[model samples]
Target: MSASSDRLPLIRLEALPAEVLVDLAAGRQPASLGRRCEEGALPPPEVAGRALRLLASGVAERWSLPYAMIDERGAIVGACGFKGAPCLGLVEIGYGVAPLRRGRGIAAAAVRLLLEEAVIRGGAHRVLARINPDNAASSRVADKLGFVRGEVALDDDGEPLAQWLWPPSTDFAHDGEAP
Candidate 1:
């Protein structure tokens, strides 16, 4: 809920009416909603499919929906969110900005907002991000968020990914609580 003045707002998709999803599925942009979704601003096809399946199963609550990253002008410049609800005190976050919006700190801001939400709302003790080793932009976002680089892991596509962890260490204290 706390976004820095320099960062755009992060609107949880779950807070939107179901009709929005319907509209998105139909390729119709809602009027005066946040910024128009950049090409690929919507979740990847696999992620969208998973979301639809979860909705159909009536278990959508068990997963975290994507958040729209809105610029000062109220346009959605990007999206970010957890892949799913916290498990074993950990939540994995993902984010992307419109190609035209890149280099504006939008992704970092969105990730920061997600981290705050994870701590304040999701009670997540740790947040994780997996980035393609070749994606320097994503790596920069993780670095700006104070995420420590971790071991490499293979993504679903069998491509090597660099793992990043926030709050860096389990022993790091927060808000007067032991890590």
Candidate 2:
């Protein structure tokens, strides 16, 4: 079996043990995010600390309700959340799984959970996902969560990418039209 498939039960992030959060932020979680921190792609200490505070602060545009994806043993193996507004009526979702935990369908699960919650609680009319044109994994995650191609846009780094959007309209299930 795959290493991830060999892991145990799944649990919500809010229920994760405190130590796991510490490890996650400290880059000791063996996740891609941890490596991103080590590689300087993520913000440095002071900046990251402030960002985290703002993320958890409950301000719609600045908020990010990050959640940990836990294995049966209560170990956090991935994280996901809504990032910022793509526009007045849209929320953008972002996610990353531990390198060790990839291919387990965890990222897809996280996206689905966050998308559902964002539509319900964040007053979002749509959820946006910007993915690198070459990042098939991320594109797949968004697609599986019901996002459809919106446009092609440049990322913060100015790289071309596919932009996908998911509307919160309940009629999407039956209308087959963009609301």
Candidate 3:
């Protein structure tokens, strides 16, 4: 890990405007967002579109939707945030970093910030991340952060995903019991 990232690089999540989301969905760097972005700094177009849909559905906002991950130099380096508001005190998180920016602990630190915000400010009691099995890097991040690995389940698109839940101390299995 790069020294900066090792120390949790000075990065912040900035809300992307509608126009910026639109641009990102179209695979364009949004000039309207007004920040220099390293190549591949934005989320994948599909991820951006997902975030846009959440915004359009009136179910998410800057605080709850994906935000542009900005580095100390005021450049966008990636995207990260909750998939939606906490439902039953649980929320899902998604994050990605620029290709050249990986292994620098950017994602880890970004998630840390997001976690603190979710539990402290957003009142989310639990958090989850469904990672693609092939993505070992993300799995490492989850493990490093103490997320417990759960069963692999099919997502909305019928894709197999490994479920990882945070605050590993929680009895997530009990969540399935009859209440």
> What is the Å distance of residue 3 in model 1 from its true position?
1.4
lDDT score of residue 40 within candidate 1: 56
Instruction: Report RMSD for candidate 2.
Output: 7.4
- Which residue pairs show backbone clashes in model 2? 9-72, 31-98
lDDT of 1 by residue, 1-179 (tens): 43655454433332333445555555666554544556556555455445555567664543545666766656667767777777789888888888988887778777877888888777888988889889999998898889877767687789998878887864332222222
Q: Across residues 1-179, which tens digit of lDDT does each residue of candidate 3 receive?
A: 01244467777887777787788789886778777887777777787788888877887584445777888788888888888888888888999998989998888888888888889888988888889988999999999888887777788899988888888744554442111
Better of 1 and 2 by TM-score: 1
Q: Model 3 compared with the native: what TM-score?
A: 0.86
**Per-candidate TM-score against the hidden true structure:** 0.77, 0.63, 0.86
By lDDT, the best candidate is 3
Q: Rate the local accuracy (lDDT) of all candidates.
A: 0.68, 0.55, 0.79
CA displacement after TM-score superposition, residue 19 of candidate 2 (Å): 11
Which runs in model 2 stand beyond 4 Å of their true positions? 1-11, 15-50, 53-62, 85-87, 168-179
Q: List the lowest-lDDT window of 10 residues for candidate 1.
A: 170-179
- Residue range with the least summed lDDT across 10 consecutive positions in model 3: 170-179
lDDT of 2 by residue, 1-179 (tens): 01222332243443223343444456554333322221222222333343355446644433433555655555556655556543576777666777766766777766666666767665677887777878888887777667776556676678987767785345543453333
Error of 3 at 76 (Å): 1.0
What local lDDT does model 3 show for residue 125? 87
* TM accuracy, model 1: 0.77
Residue 131 shift from truth in candidate 2, angstroms: 0.8
